[model samples]
Target: MRKLPAGRAGVAPAPLPEESASRPLHSVSGTPSPLPPAPRELTVRALVMGGLIGSVLAVTNVYMGLKTGLWESGCVLSSLLAFGGLSVLARRGAPPSPLETNLAQTTAVSVGAMPASAGLLGAVPALTLLGTQPPGWAVALWGVGLGTLGVLFAFSLRRRLLEEEALPFPTGAAAAELISTLHSTGSAYAARARGLWTSGLVSGVLTWLRDASQLVPPVSLLPAAMRVGGMGPETLSLGMAWNPMLLGIGVLVGLQAGLSILLGSLVAWLGLAPWLVREGVATGATPDALRESLAAWLLWPGVGLMVGAAATSIASQVRALPAVLADLRGLARYGEGWEATASRWVARAVLPVILLTGAMGWFAFHLSPLYFLLALVLAVPLCAVCARATGQTDIAPISPVGQFAQGAFGMLAPPLPSLNASAGAVVSGAASHASGSLWSLQAGRLLGTSASRQLLVQLSGLLLGAAVALPTYHLLVSVHGLDSQALPVPTGRQFKAVAELLTARGLEGLPRSSTLATGVAFALGVVLSAAARGRLARLLPSAAAMGLGFLLPASYAVTLCLGTLLAALVGRLRPSTTQTVQSAGAGAIVGESLVGVFVSALSLMRQG
Candidate 1:
């Protein structure tokens, strides 16, 4: 047994068992087998349960991603859910093994991530904002193709990232730890299950009260409209939202991120917003009109900040590129069996993905053949880079990488804004999907499960996720259009802003002030990201979180800050219950998000 290195508070407080050195690592092209060569590994029951849980998580993520540009992996949560469900359904024979649970959770996590990979959240909505909404079938094909490509990319790199270098993919490690603990004792499993259910139920009820029944409304922290410097009343979009999901996100992200979000909210809402109103840069009659107008203008700098930070971070990794290339060349010359083996696997995977993605691109977005070839070439290295980033930082740089793709296509591809968004979606979706799959593989590596089996399960999960997620996305869009306040789609707005700026008629397209703000925010993001590990790191804000604050309402930032403060208090006051606190937070996120989706469907039915 061994303890994981101290991670961020609330991530993995429990110790994890180390795998035996005697056990051989599975090859990239190997078939499925139990670690002990006795108990079951890939069972039909596990796949079914995982698909069911993953289907639910897919819907939950779609709603959450559209509302806030954030979503969970659902690995740990699904593991817990599968453990409890399988325990009840098991026959008189042996209960589900840890390896079985790991496989199930892998499936759920894969399915859960399909919404983002399918571009339902960011790229697709950005195109929708530009008056282009593709059919649901196209969306499904796009998601499945890119998602499968990501899995293959991760499969090719697993040995390098997971076994050879041994980077700490924290989420995967946490899931492994939880699985080990759950199977080892009944008491531990019961405690976690109870906490999850209790929190989820409470959060669901609150969501019902707030959104469905309208008994609870967000309270404005300040006056809705406040006159400043003797100018006309400036509408302040500041409030305490009745949002448990934001609170849960705050708890998960911790203090540093929360502080950064708060800083950006104050700067954007209190300072820049009022300044814009006073200068007549943003003019609207009522508070609603004013809020919308301000958001329209502020998204540019926000996108710039996010894009700049991502670029700087990716640039910093240039030093590792040569070493990675050298290793690949060495493997090829030595005739290591795995290289040729992975080549065959990748070749088999790429053809179908290319065919489906090509069809979707041509039918839905009118993308050129160059786009497909470029995205395919870009996806390989980008996936590896994203996987490495996730391993090192436990935060996949999906949006930044996507933004990078957008910039590349902007210069090279045709000047159509929808084409740019679609290209970004293809690349970013593949990166995000690959990184998440790698996390599951990391957990499988620890649990002595077959990587090949896990890969197959992940592929199945992707198909299941695409089938379920696309319909859910369409339903939500049909009921409450993409532009509704209920689904602000911050990242989507960012993509729209970038596409416009890139395709626009030079600087003459947007307001000069907005363009200038983009430049300044981009520079700030670059600086902040570059300085993150410097001596003054403790004093620096999170560039990404701060950028996100500019895109969301002040209420979201405030609520996230409050959640962060609450988490801190819990950690300080009752340290023993930290894990329970984490579970509660995760449960609330899933619960509220699920309820929100349900409410949207209910609204649609009522209208019908």
Candidate 2:
């Protein structure tokens, strides 16, 4: 066994048996498993894997947003399921090769962004309504715009964030733990697969029932407070409602992260939302407005916190970058067979294809060429930052860079009127998401998978998913009247609030107490983060954030916080088995999301 440097708490990087040296990183057990050799070429199998996993990711995200008013966390859950399942599968008789594992892990992580990507389809309807036919170039440009810009922006910071810092890629760490444990027993793959399918089915069914109005109770039980005197009327809130799926998310997120989200929600729902409703600044405190409100409040502070935290955290991980890059370069030089060259050629081919597709999208969407160009420029740096933040420097410069480029363009110069700069903000949020995926890919690499092959498969999956998702979104909208104005697409309560600010007659108003309160909350987060230690320190920001979320609506934040607290309790109680518990909780999240999507799709089919 290679004696590596001691890690945190003197724990060495997980040991791999010498016999497994020839196997890919994912199959490091070195056992004589009968897994198939990694595919040298892009094939039907790879594409199907990406597509199926991407779909699950999409469902998970949709359900997460619906259940807990958070979208980014879904990516974390999807990564866990995909990698965890593959790890377990690789241990069984039909174990996956290292390349296969890499492909699966990469594709799954990339696919996690599908829902957000597909959301771009809304541009079409909005443009059509404006009586303008967006050309293919416009649509393609939009893609190139966000993809390039987001990458650039992320990349500029990669050295500082990913290379220099060792921010805990919490989700990634969780995924790696699961993969390692599963590989140990060889049965982890089967268990993960079971979890994936089960979650998908459960989520799908719930979504369908809710859509069809068969499960109205879930939506109706809004937390409300009655006013006894004439000071005010009764108020309805969505602070801490319960659903099986959101609870699962809470469990996976544990207390720290979950609490932060809940705190954010509370500040918006309980504090700001009520004021907005009473002052007629917004419509009543309905469930629809809850997410928007929270988003609006979180925009600057949340982004600031995320960026600061990520930058600071990733600074610690930068030391690993040189070795990672050297490894890649070494592979390029020594692995000079046709297969290696083939992978290189594939990457080359994919770049132009992505560029061409992006160009076409820009024209089709009638996007501004300037915005597209800027996005392209920005994508490089943004990806670097994301890589640094997530501790997955290798994958950061690729998928996320591209996606961010597209998102940045779409947001900055979206074809639709309703889709504004905030769209760019939302796309910028992709850095956090891409960071999570980077961790998954890193796990694959650690297990000895080829980086080049993983890149190819993941890119292929993203393209396929984009193709299907665009049309699927259109069909759903046309048949079901699923307009953003109604369903809100990517813009939730936060976007609505921003829109209100734009449309409001006079936005040059004085500051309110809520603003002060928000500032105080942010300061509290920083202080708590500094003062706390170990798990408490790690969790302080999230806890403070959750407290703020709870103040939004006692009911919603309360339930969510409680759920998170329960999970944290579990972690504390069973530190050795935290990953297993987290996996189960993540499984539940996957189940709820998958079933919800299934139900939505079924309902749509039945309607058709």
Best by lDDT: 1
Return the TM-score for candidate 1, rounded to 2 decimals.
0.90
Candidate 2 lDDT at 338 equals 40
Clashes of 2: 124
After superposition on all C-alphas, the RMSD of every candidate to the true structure, in Å, is 5.6, 8.0
Candidate 1, 1-608: lDDT as tens digits: 13244233222222122333345657567964445444467898899999999998898888888888888888788888988877876876568988888889999999999998998889999998998878888888888888988887777677778877888898888888788788877787776777678888988999999889999874445563455433333355567888888888898888898999888877888789878977899877777897888888888788778888888878877667665555434432321343455446665666777888888877886676778778666666666677788888888999788888878878987788888888888888998788899889888777777677787888889889999898888888888788667788998988887787777544567764898898999999999988986887778998888999988888888998998999899999989777777788888888997888888889999999
lDDT of 1 at 419: 82
Assess candidate 1 and give its lDDT.
Answer: 0.80
For each candidate in the order shown, give its overall lDDT on alpha carbons.
0.80, 0.44
Alpha carbon lDDT of residue 558, candidate 1?
90
Output the lDDT of residue 298, model 2: 43
Model 1 residue 366 lDDT score: 69
TM-score, per-candidate, Cα-based: 0.90, 0.65
